[model samples]
Target chain A: MKKIFDFIDLNAEIQWVIVIILIILITATLTFQIWKKVKPSNLVDEMMLRTKSWWGMCFIFLFASLVHPIVTYLGLAFLSFFTLREIYTLLKLRDSDRTVLLACYLSIPFQYYFAFQGWYTMFLIFIPVFLFIIIPFLLVLSGDTTDIISSMCILPTSLMLGVFGISHLGLLISFPEMNTGNISGKALLLFLIFITEANDIMQFICGKIFGKHKILPNVSPNKTWEGFIGGVICSMIIGYFMGFLTPLETLPLILISACIAILGFMGDAIISAVKRDFGVKDMSDVIPGHGGYLDRIDSLSTTSSPFFHLIYFLLLA
Target chain B: MKKLILTLIYTVFWRSFNKIIIGLKYHNHKSLRKKKQFILIANHNSHMDTMAIMSAMPSKYIHRVHPIAASDFFGGTKLNKFLMKYLVNAILIPRKKANSDKDIDPIEVISKLLNKGRSVILYPEGSRGTPGVMSNFKKGIGYLIQKHPEIDVIPVYLDGIYKTLPKGTSIILPYNCNIIFGKKIDFHSLEIDDIVLKSEESIQKLIKRE
Candidate 1:
């Protein structure tokens, strides 16, 4: 125990203290949550009570799993798998669309494979050109063209943006090649997920507390302009300070994190449009307080491409 | 040999291409394709209701199911006669025919079929009412319930079929519907008149959902 304390770094000790503080916060929050459930609230109050559990669980896992590298990757991989499956459920498929659908499954391994192998070029090109070109000809050969134009527009775009676009978490983890200890990879991943997820919680709270101006009332009734700007400003300040603990540049860090925040909002809106078209709400009832696989990973889907694009230009290019 | 020949000719080739594309959903869909008998009482909308019923049920249970069709609709043409005899294997029951002395015994026939432990699908509304409302049922179905009161009643709710093939529409477009099967009901200890009233109530509850 004495020798273990001898080589302990100051920053590492601060991180440990932060982790401990988070654990206490989660425990206290959850206890109050149970109290709310037992004492019984009205309908609106009951909804907020359950939503507290959702926000609580998200933070507790994020705090604990941020330090573990392999645990974080596998966790993100499972999130990708579920979000893709939910997308598949909402969209209608034809016989000619089979090959394209199969190729969509291939992206799961390809995304993680690139992340695992630490390659950047193959990860970017695999989805855009290769999968893109191969899928349409397969549909053309089937010769069912009555809904061909509609199928071509909707199917490939849905698979690309919803499935392939969101899978850039693997690429995000493979960034930060400068650190000698191989510790920064885990730090960067944990930092990114924590900040992005915090945006979702804060926006919901802000929207409920002080929302007035409807942003896109036709599309998402709950979303307000006040919530969007509030979430962006909060995430930018959070991501900027978070970068000081790790090895990331400041100006681009805040600017890019704000961009990630806006795109995250877009990602949530796009998936909402899919649910709207089919006249359904909340894809599946798998998660209790959270809507579904699609609901949980809506923000992570938008972070992948831009975050990695910045990485390519800054580090590899 | 007969079943094999029929399966080879219709099921494998023709039914594959000719299978109707109607949306079907259920809450607990685990046993949807199972062989449990469903008295699929639906409000008659068009001449194609029985065909919709047959195609909607999975191929496993299609052969055993017998539909009670009105004598006025399928009792005239040779093609209709072949379909009623062979394809659906419908039990042709006469409607209110003008001044005919043929007193057909539907209660005894239905009771005997239920006694043989076979499930039959009958439209309890007698004939298709105007698009939405179900007409009052005739006494033959009520009498059948009185004779054999052990069979289960499954209420099937079909949507969009009225618009798909309405009364006077010649050309039909592709549409969808949901065939919901309720839980089984037992009437083993009820009186004869009570059996009729209860059966009527059970069917009415299923229709009231639409």
Candidate 2:
């Protein structure tokens, strides 16, 4: 239990996170009250609901980060399960794909289990290599030849995004810290999430305020070059200062922030492309106004993997 | 004792299981809010279809709701009869008669139950069909509605039940199921053909899938 406590960093850095969250929650609640009195649009209620959920998310994350490392891992595993369920729910799966879907759902727990064990080698390739071989073999055994190729194509990509991609965030906290600067697991995980999510919110706000020219009009019409630049600039500045929470130097943090900005956009765009292909406005209404977990974490699905690898290469590796 | 077991199976056990499988997407549950008795007509594909609908009914109304089960199948054996009687509160309607047995009239039984202010469940298809495909409506439902013109019919579409637990298979897959209850149909004059066609058509619209 003490070792678990040692792994978690409830230091000045995390204290700052709690303060910031409190400020944001208070400000959001006040704004909701004021906006309800002044000019309440349907959008106001939606924004209010988003803020409410954000408070829930922030507190739960803080508690998990403070309690033990295992909670964070299991929390992420739970998120991946819901996200995977959302993906499969929207997909018009064939009868042949039933076994494959079940296999994909089962892979989530195994991936996180590996993450918990700190089996980096197995965690990195479990879904892509292990489940990749196992699923197709199971499909062949089922004797349903129809829709096999498409099932093979969709299953791996969805699992990679829904299971493998999201589980990296859990793995991030479990990675061994280097002795050079002694950056704690909770602080690093919090920092990565902060930058990635801040980038998302900043982009949406900037896009709504000043966005005119569409970056990818066909794919994500809401995205604009103005919003993109603004989000990158804001996120980079935050990432540069958040170096205190991480072991990386300013230059490396800057580079990582840039990667998060571009990759986050690309990640979000790729999921937008998927939603477009499926002709769904959002994945599902699991998160009330925010659609589903997939809708909220589309950027995280892309950002977490590369960010973890970058940290690994720079410090721990 | 009978109602207790029936409520336990339908309300607690099957409801939880179906909720896990599909989250049991129930639509127009507002239609079930009224205290007035109405017959529920649904498309039958899997055995789970009945429970799926029963689970969605409010607890206040569930005690008064009785499902009309096929007597030949559900009442064929002693154990099957016990389960159907207690677990489902099923009022068995004979589909086929034995050599020595008399032809049981389902219309008489259904009318008697409806007159007693009890809501009944009926499958217009008479039996479970291939999941995702609807069979032609039998005259049994038409006869019931024609006889009891005062009882409104609630058309329900049990989507994905076939995929979850198709006919001739006991293996229950965890496929998501949706129960959509359409508006109650109260035909003015008693016409079996008109009531059956309209009831079938109403349930068809509730199905979003092909």
Candidate 3:
């Protein structure tokens, strides 16, 4: 296994991560297949659909990561675009909000461009500082100030969460410090994504099996104390072993993963609240079983920036 | 050759645009390619509606499919006429014929296309109505169905194109849209009013399905 990974053009860490993901996917497929044969239920069918989507997602993620940096940038930008578009669709913004929404969509490419150029300062402030003011101004220019406050609130937050937060993953690749030895920025990205997604899955499983006390019944009825604690612990354990992917020490790595797990939960809860407020079960049915891009990336959207900043502060800063 | 070029462009451009930008999903899309000739009726909102329907169609059937667009709207200028005729493969029929030409009938134009084994997309609403609101379908569709009872009428309910590129807006916001192709209605032995009522009800049912 080591020899084959080493022989591959990709760094051994990324190759190993890919192998681990494949093993998990295959095991899940087998487990689901067995579960279906044993007892056919809607849960099994839903899980099968989710697993199929995961396979496609894994392929796309692997392709984006393994290809040149431009592909990764473009892929991330497209994700942001889709996320923002999904949010706008869900918000049901008025025709007056169209111009502002257009401006918000246009900002995605610029945000990713900054990441591609490795313009850290500009990337950090571009959406938050620049578009923050420009969006509302554009809304004002539209001359339909009915529900302007909501537009002001939703547009900037959408950009911040969808574009600004997710663009960190792109900027992470441009860091020269992240490309140390065999573990490049791609490995770190894969590590972040794996931990974030694994934490989500862990929380879900724990909640299903051992969940009793509701955490936020109003926002998300499914989340529980058991899920949160169990997920964080499980994430920390995974992060400790996956520490080789990053340049951080063991203590910092464990702490960061815990933060990621907690933040990931917060992100999921917030998005759930937004969906519940708007009376939507899912953002959209873009992905077959996963709901939409926003549904799948809610955790990652909240985790990406924090993960990026933490790594930067610990290693680069 | 122009038709072939248009097919190629639709296969590549409109398909990709609908799939990627619009995220156009379909329900009962297989039924669309099952028939060689049919009247595809959908609620029109944006110019993207025609493109979305065309993109949903298979490339082999694209050349034979003509969306019945209004000449006054789509054929006002020479360039619009050329593009509407060639690029979109749309058969432009005048919404209101000139006083001099009393014989220029829209149904006759559509029947000619059907006679050639070509499918035509008709917006029974007659024009683009308010976004997200279904208007009363005009009687022209009923008249056409009465004349050609042999052709099947397929009701397609298009959602979210108005939000993507609504009327009075050229800038397309990338909002996901869906095309729901209802089961084909055989208007055989049905009156013009019955045909109209059935098709309208079919689309209304699709809107409720979500």
Candidate 4:
């Protein structure tokens, strides 16, 4: 045991610094949780729950980074499973939705399998070409044989939001231009989540304080024009600072952050529409004072699905 | 254990939000609050009837409540899987009857949940029958109460379930089912063979509204 500890990299200075900083942060968070003003809230509670998830996610990603890049990607794929589960729960699915549901469920494991095997072409084809084309017909199989709307809308909507829209996050594995930064994709994954979540919290706080005019009360009542305006500005600033801290370039980072926040709101809105129709609160109650599986990932369900591909298309292409 | 808690929490959120729109009620809730550890038999009028019993029960009891969902229907789909795993905490048992000589039985599972300090909800008159009328119950309740003499065999009627979301309707109608808890049956005096007959008679008597 002594010899095992000896060969271990006990001499790494950076590891010690990371350990100390993490200890301090954990201590502070526990102290805040105990003494901070804990109120029953629709919004603030959502913010803290998300922040806890971010901490958990960071540890998972960092831990995975030690093993292999494929393992890190697999860890991310598991995250996608729960995230997709959340999205699937929010939307209503007809019996015909099963084939596509199978396809959508199959996409995560398959994409990660590609990332695991280092098969870039199959991974790229799986979501866009395969999932995009197949899901709509899976809707048709629902045999709404006469009325095209249910087959058209419900089936395609879930797969696009669940599968096709978010395929590009996996595409990051082979993304060539991004390699120049040398920051692991897991780090970028963490970065995306942090900025997106921070934007959500800031928007809620800004909206609560200064919100007067409703942005689209029909779709989402809690959202406001002021909140949207304030959230984007704060997100851009936060993204800029993050870019500087990571030593990544500036203008693009700010633009990406703004994009995540704006798109995150759209995702939140779509999920809200689902809950409203179902007459249910939060997707499920997995978290204390929070709703179900879907509620936790409404943003990712909406944002990442589309955002990943858009980034690959715009930047990589 | 984690699955049960998650289901209870999921159901609580759903009930709170659904109550805002569905508009449901339970009469004489105070008498029903104190009781625990029972084989609850209820009329299966609609899907909402299940939700009514779930929402009306206290959270602690709700945690212990295991609805005996039919495997053919409840186990067959992803949505049902989510609901069974994370919303209802339901125990899906096969509905098919065992052969005459077969030793393996479905009652064994129900008997187990009762032993583990949990209450089991069994719709004795299997299948969602027509709303507002009593369907003929099978001998399963009689068989169960006879076998597990310790568990309280409580009779419950979901008063408004027929209209809440009536049978054969695909869409969930905007209606609330009110649950009425009748008296619990005492089987301490009965013999082994007499147990089945007595329990069946007791359930019939309790189903009648005064």
On TM-score, the candidate that comes out on top is: 3
lDDT of 4 at A225: 91
Order the candidates by lDDT, highest first.
3, 2, 4, 1
Error of 2 at A160 (Å): 0.6
Chain A TM-scores of each predicted structure, in the order given, are 0.80, 0.92, 0.96, 0.74
Better of 2 and 4 by TM-score: 2
True contacts kept of each: 0.00, 0.07, 0.79, 0.00
Worst 10 residues of 3 chain A by lDDT: A1-10
lDDT for each residue of candidate 2 in B57-92, tens digit (9 for 90 to 100): 777668789889988778888999888777777889
* Candidate 2: residue A240 lDDT (0-100): 88
Q: For every candidate structure, what is the RMSD over all alpha carbons to the true structure, in angstroms?
A: 10.3, 4.2, 2.0, 11.8
Worst 10 residues of 4 chain B by lDDT: B169-178
Q: Whose DockQ is greatest here?
A: 3
Residue A277, model 4, lDDT: 83
Quote each prediction's TM-score. Answer: 0.58, 0.86, 0.95, 0.58
In the range A29-148, model 1's lDDT, one tens digit per residue, is 676667667885564465554566555565655643554546655665555665565565556665455555555655667766766566667766766766677667766876777677
lDDT of each: 0.62, 0.79, 0.86, 0.64
DockQ of each: 0.04, 0.28, 0.76, 0.06
For model 4, state the Cα shift of residue A91 in Å: 4.6
| DockQ agreement of candidate 1 with the native complex | 0.04
Model 1 CA deviation exceeding 4 Å by range: A1-78, A174-183, A311-317, B1-183, B186-210
> What fraction of native interface contacts is shared by candidate 3?
0.79
Q: Write the per-residue lDDT of candidate 4 for residues A1-317, one digit (tens) a residue.
A: 12223455522322433354377458646755654475545454555565576566547655764356667666566556655655554454443444556566676777777755646678657766776677677766666665556655665456555544444455554455544564344445555666676677678879999999999888778899999889999999977765622334677778788888998888778888888887776755455544654565567666664555555555556
